[model samples]
Target: MRRVAVIGTGVIGASWAAHFLAHGLDVVASDPAPGAEARLRADVAAIWPTLAPIDGASPDRLTFTADAAEAVADADFVQENGPEREEVKDALFAVLDTAARPEVVLASSSSGLLPSVIARGCPEHPERVVIGHPFNPPHLIPLVEVVPGEKTAEKTVETAMAFYAGVGKRPIRLRQELPGHVANRLQAALWQEAYSLVERGVATVADIDTAITHGPGLRWAVLGPFLTQHLSGGPGGIAHVLEHLGPPTEAWWRDLGQVTLTRELVETLVAGVDEELAGIDRAELVAHRDAVLTALLAAKARTELP
Candidate 1:
């Protein structure tokens, strides 16, 4: 698609706009918030430097509109990144379904809310609505979970997948509609145990963060869990790991901690994070992380890791 509409100019929406513009597509964006246009432009400009060498991005192709309908009108695709409220999304989708062409796929950037509920108000063309959830900092991250609701047409799913792939995103088609999709669920599972550790005084927040960032996180960036486990089987591969270690792994899983975020636990987590980030500036940390991520991605591209 040559042109696209971005509804809601928040961080995710702005990142989507930047990524689309980096691929040389014209972006018509709309956000009602005061100074949203200026912020969106500044965000695009800031991120353009990172994307320019990769895709020759130019900010000249972006247009900001006050009306969401005007933004989506005549657009090839529509990406909605509004707030994560069912009622809000339902109302917004009703308008978008009417404003955009019938064939133009309308995707939501919802992190977890199901497309089925979000598009419930779109009686005329609920089939065109689907979830196109992207990881944070979409300009750098490659993952985009393309999930279709029950009413979403098969052709619409195919179109959404193809469009995301065409724009250099790694899109995965989920077979079932589950809350939090795949990655977020996996992250939540890990965090559940991580919080348990902190709650039980097994590890301080800094210690846990360091353990992941310096240990598993490094390998995870290159290979996922199953592959890493397969490789860990010495010459036996996953079959052997499953055969010999499966029972022990199951035992460990059974013994894993479960936690609920009570008030005390919440305070503990907040204080731990505060102590960990005592002197660090949030913006500087983000910049450092993004720089490292950019370099890591470039290095990974030169290797055969898949």
Candidate 2:
């Protein structure tokens, strides 16, 4: 098994550590904060029972360190989740380049910043650096966007896809580098519509939640939106649905709002959320999210995969 180093210890980073370890890979995690090491170790331990039951798995090894170089010294792969600021990412990758093997692949859990930006200050920059952006709680969510920057090596992309697949992640090769990548971009599109609807008083916060949670989201759990639509229109496939629904879809696209996150809009959104989640505590919400995500992943594993 390869040794993997997770270069940040926040929730996303800790989740990566948990997944790598559960897959039987030795994971060495590093973060600069004084107590980050212990916190990471504890987070991984807490998530284990939930993870173990997913694939009947156990890690072959584990290690913790505060020094980035020490954490990545002999690692086969480095998964970074440091501060999203370009300068911080550049500095960290530069250090990682010096410590990791020349051929070792480096991946980022960044949701938006392009790989080119993160690779700028590193000696090994383009050849081995690529975005391995995963959905939140990567241990449970399987979609990993394997995005390649302009200078990223062809072989690097292939190796990353293969590597992620080995760990049981569903890796998608995005054709080009785009801010927010694919899934997030799609999500943001829906969010824009949802917000606009709320702002226009067409729906309440809870109504928007129900529309997705009970409607398209249910079928989407089994198949993606396009495929679901295709199935809905019968054997004529995607073409049939498009022929019928294309006009309205195009109209919606044309009318979509480019609303900025203005102060007033932000306040409205925040207030709505506060009202919606009035009685729920943050910790309880997180627990609820984890439980739902676990069940969703398990159901996906059984129903979506062959």
Candidate 3:
């Protein structure tokens, strides 16, 4: 079995550690925070059952240390989930670079930090550094963005991709790096429009959410926007859909409201959310969402959706 070193045993790190363990990979986790090991172990134990364990998986496969270098000393792969600060990351990677083997893939879980900037601290083997950004709560989310830096080696990217796939993640390779990567950019566009509509008195927060949840969101879960459009066009496919809807879509885009979040707007948005979620326990809502998401994922795995 492979060994994965998880530096920074916080939410993302703990999730990654649990995931590695679930796949029967021994995980050595490190974090400097007081009681970090306890918290990480507890979190992993809690999340372990939800993951469909295979390959002789068990939470007992995990070990922890306060020393980051010690964790990576004999690890097959190193996943850095330290604080999302460049200086902190640079300093941490410098320590990691000196400890880990030259060929071991050093991957980051950074949401937006560029891998090139991150590779600055590892002059010895900058080519081995790459981004393996997973969606939040890594174990539950299937998408892992395997992004490479300017100096990231092709071998490193290939290794990271294979490792993530081995752990049951759906890894997508980015041809070029971009701010917020791909999925976040798509979500940001939808969020901007949602915010604009609320600001322009077009819809309540609940109604806007309903519009997506009861409508396009269902289709989106099955396939991406382009493919959904193709299916919607029947025999015409995407080309026909574009020929028919392209002009009107462009018109809607031209009219989308641009919003700047002022203090008042922030308050309005918060209040809107509060009202929408009134009388609903946040924990229960999260539980329901996760339960449904898990079912959806299981169902998707049985298909050739893409």
The C-alpha lDDT values of all candidates are 0.92, 0.86, 0.91
Task: Please rank every candidate by lDDT, starting with the best.
Answer: 1, 3, 2
lDDT of 1 by residue, 1-306 (tens): 899999998999999999999898999999989999999999988888777433545789899998988899879999999999998898888889899999999999999999899879788899999999999899899999999999999999999999999998899999999999899999999999999999999999999999999999988988989888889888999999999999999999998999999999999999999899998988888788789988988888899555
Q: State candidate 2's TM-score.
A: 0.93
Summarize candidate 2's per-residue lDDT along 1-306 as a digit string, tens digits: 478999998999998989988887878889999899788878888878667633444543667788999988899888999988898988899899888888888899999999888778577555899999998888888899999887789998999999999998999999988999999999998999888877777887778888998999888878898889889888888898899989998997898776677787777788888888988998798788889988887777777656
Q: Report per-prediction Cα RMSD to one decimal.
A: 1.3, 2.0, 1.5
Cα lDDT tens digits for candidate 3, 204-284:
989999999999999998898989999989898999989999999999999988888889788889999899999888767
Best lDDT goes to which candidate?
Answer: 1
Worst 10-residue lDDT window, candidate 2: 52-61
Say which prediction, candidate 1 or candidate 2, comes out ahead on lDDT: 1
Alpha-carbon shift of residue 241 in model 1 (angstroms): 0.9
Can you rank all candidates by TM-score, best first?
A: 1, 3, 2
